[model samples]
Target: MSWSDRRHLLRVLVPGLLAASLSGCGFQPMLAPGSPGAALSGRVLVDAPTDRAAFDLVDRLEQRLGRAETPAYRLSYSINLREQGLGVTPEGATTRYNLDGSITYALREIGGDAIVASGRVESFTSWSATGSTLSTLGAEEDARQRLMQILADQIVTRLLAAAP
Candidate 1:
């Protein structure tokens, strides 16, 4: 076969062969219908947010695992966040900060005491503080939002994997 023709054939055949192999190995998409992830979607109730960080985390969780109309599981969580100054000016001012956060969460049946899934997820984000007061505040808030989203995604992944 011509070089161009061989390359074109390989492009099509490779993907087809990969798909065939994946199916043979019993590989399934996590969010596909009837999968463990689908079973948890829209059936988990996240605890109410008590602060800005908690609010952001809960919001992302609900976005991923749809808000439950009739909750079968209650998700309770505690958030711990710490900020440490990273970059310091020659004089005494801080120019940058690192925000470290961790969350301990548990998923339990609404009417039962047994914990179905529980774990702690930790993540960090940084922001520059060498700007105007307003700009620094904005950067800090954005970092916090990003951190919460990351933590929430980790939680959802764990919950999906733990789903029966």
Candidate 2:
């Protein structure tokens, strides 16, 4: 067959083959309205946040997974945070810092002793400390919130990927 002919043949045939394979495998979109993972919405109760970073993390998770009206599952999480000086001035003053955050989470069916899923997620954000003290404090708080959002999103993505 000519190159053009083979190109045309593949364009027509590949999609049909993919459709046939997928149709037989019972594939369904995880986050779709009626899919299995959709049932998680409004059904997971996140443990109460103990601090500001935890509060931000729970807020983002609830934004993604929906708040529990009548919880069928429990999400328990613990957060660890560290501040590391990133850049130092020639005079030995810290000019930049990184806020590193990690969260360990577990999901379990309500009233059950077994864990359905569990893992840890880590992220970091940097802030410049060269500015005024108030400005630097604001930047650090913003970085902390951003890190929480990132980690929470990662946890939700993992949950959706593993949802059946």
Candidate 3:
């Protein structure tokens, strides 16, 4: 091939390579299956210290976790999900019109002060406004949902970390 042809080929090939390389990322949005909530029945538990978080956790777990599983293998350890707050903030100066608080939680399989699978995540919920970009309750919900999934994974990591 001529030098010009080789240059042209490289130009075309580079973009194709770039596109393919960028296409495959683990990040993806999950599609819901008719329902809007989930239940717990397997090894995971959302037993909160307070009633409010417990109820909220229940809804979130059901909403995000999908459904409960009455598994045969009893989980050797129990992981707890606790929250720090239940609200969202826009920037820092301005607050949402709706209620705005914070929620922080961790997954810990407590035995001799041992943290099994644990992580801390936060979310924001607000009825700031329809056109208002700040305090988007929808975005807060999304963050909260994903945080639970991450917590589940952290639990697995803790399990593996404890393994001999």
Candidate 4:
């Protein structure tokens, strides 16, 4: 090939290769049905209390997941609350807000015993906004709900998929 032609090809290929390598950083669903894992359905038992709102969210997930015939694989969960604050601002606006850290958990059968598979979702919002206190609560609740779904789906997928 001519020198100019070779240079042009190198220019195109170098950028194209770099772009493809960097594209994997985006979120991806790693586990799916029919993957290299168990081929069965099982029951999930969450350990969190049945009275809390987070537990209710998990109950919704259990209903939609239907049933599994794998002799009811035990599902367990735990919830821990955490508190933290952002650094003070330079303009003298100093305050720290609250965050609701809810962790969802599940388990699956191993060689002879069940192993825990868990995920956590943290919901936080600033309460200092003017007016609409209830609105802020609504927004925080929405975030929690979405986080629950995501955690549930991830745990289920991991439980079903074979260890990679």
Candidate 5:
């Protein structure tokens, strides 16, 4: 076979081979029916938000895990955030800032006190401060929102991995 024909054949054959191997190994999507993720979906009740940051986190968690109507598990989390200057101008003015965030979460059976899964996830986002006061404030808020989303995604991934 010519080089072009061989290349085209390989492109199709490789994916078919990969799919066959994956199925033979019992590989299935995490969110597929009867999977751990499917079992946990819409079954976790996240703690109520107490502030804007908490609200963002809860919103994302709900978006990922679905809102529980009859909850089997309760997820409680605490968000800790810190801001540090990352870039400085020649005159010692802060030009960029980093928002470091961490969430400590625990999942427990709704009516029981024993913890089922617990973990802490950390992430960071940055925003530019070299702008007008209003623009700087907006950038900082955007960074905070992104940080919360990152932390929430981590929480959901961990919960899915730990689901029974």
Candidate 6:
């Protein structure tokens, strides 16, 4: 068969196979409207953030898990953040730095105070320090925000995956 015909055939065949396999495996979206994740939504009380990055992290978590209305669980977290120089110039100047961040979180039952789930999530983001001081600071802040979002998403995914 010609290349175009082979490509078209593959396009049809791959999707059919994928669908068959997925259906058999019983894959379910973690955050579907009525899934287990939805049960935790609007029912988790997140701890008050201690800093800007922590605040951003909490904000993103709330965006994913939904804010606590009548809280059934309490989520407490601690964050560790560090910066490491990556790219260096011959003149002994660092041009890029990586912000490494990790968060350890726990979910506890509200009334009984029993721990239900806990885990740590980590990620890193890089920023260029070669720009002006203000621009560099802004870039670093933006990188921190990105890192927080990544970490928060990871935490939510873990929470969804864990048994209730």
- Using lDDT as the measure, which candidate wins? 1
Per-residue lDDT tens digits of candidate 2, residues 97-136? 9988888999999999678889998989999999999999
| Candidate number with the higher lDDT (4 or 6) | 6
Q: Per-residue alpha-carbon lDDT of model 4 for 47-88, expressed as tens digits? A: 445655567556655654544444445566765655454545
Q: Scored by CA lDDT, what does every candidate get?
A: 0.96, 0.91, 0.42, 0.53, 0.94, 0.92
lDDT of 1 by residue, 54-85 (tens): 99999999999999988999999999999999
- Runs of candidate 1 with Cα error greater than 4 angstroms are none
List model 5 lDDT by residue over 124-145, tens digit each. 9999988899999999999999
Error of 4 at 2 (Å): 30
TM-score, cand. 3? 0.33
Q: Candidate 6 on 1-164: residue-level lDDT in tens?
A: 89999999999999999989998997777766778877798898999998999899999999999999989999999999999999999999999999999999999999877889999999999999999999999999999999999999999988888847
Please give the distance, in angstroms, between residue 148's alpha carbon in candidate 5 and its true position after superposition: 0.9
The regions of model 2 sitting more than 4 angstroms off are 1-29
Give the clash count for each candidate.
Answer: 0, 0, 11, 4, 0, 0
Off by over 4 Å in 5: none
Q: Which 10 consecutive positions of candidate 4 have the poorest summed lDDT?
A: 122-131
Q: Compose the digit string of candidate 3's lDDT tens values, residues 50-155.
A: 4543344455554443343542122222334333333345654433333323334344442443444343433333333334455465655554455444544444
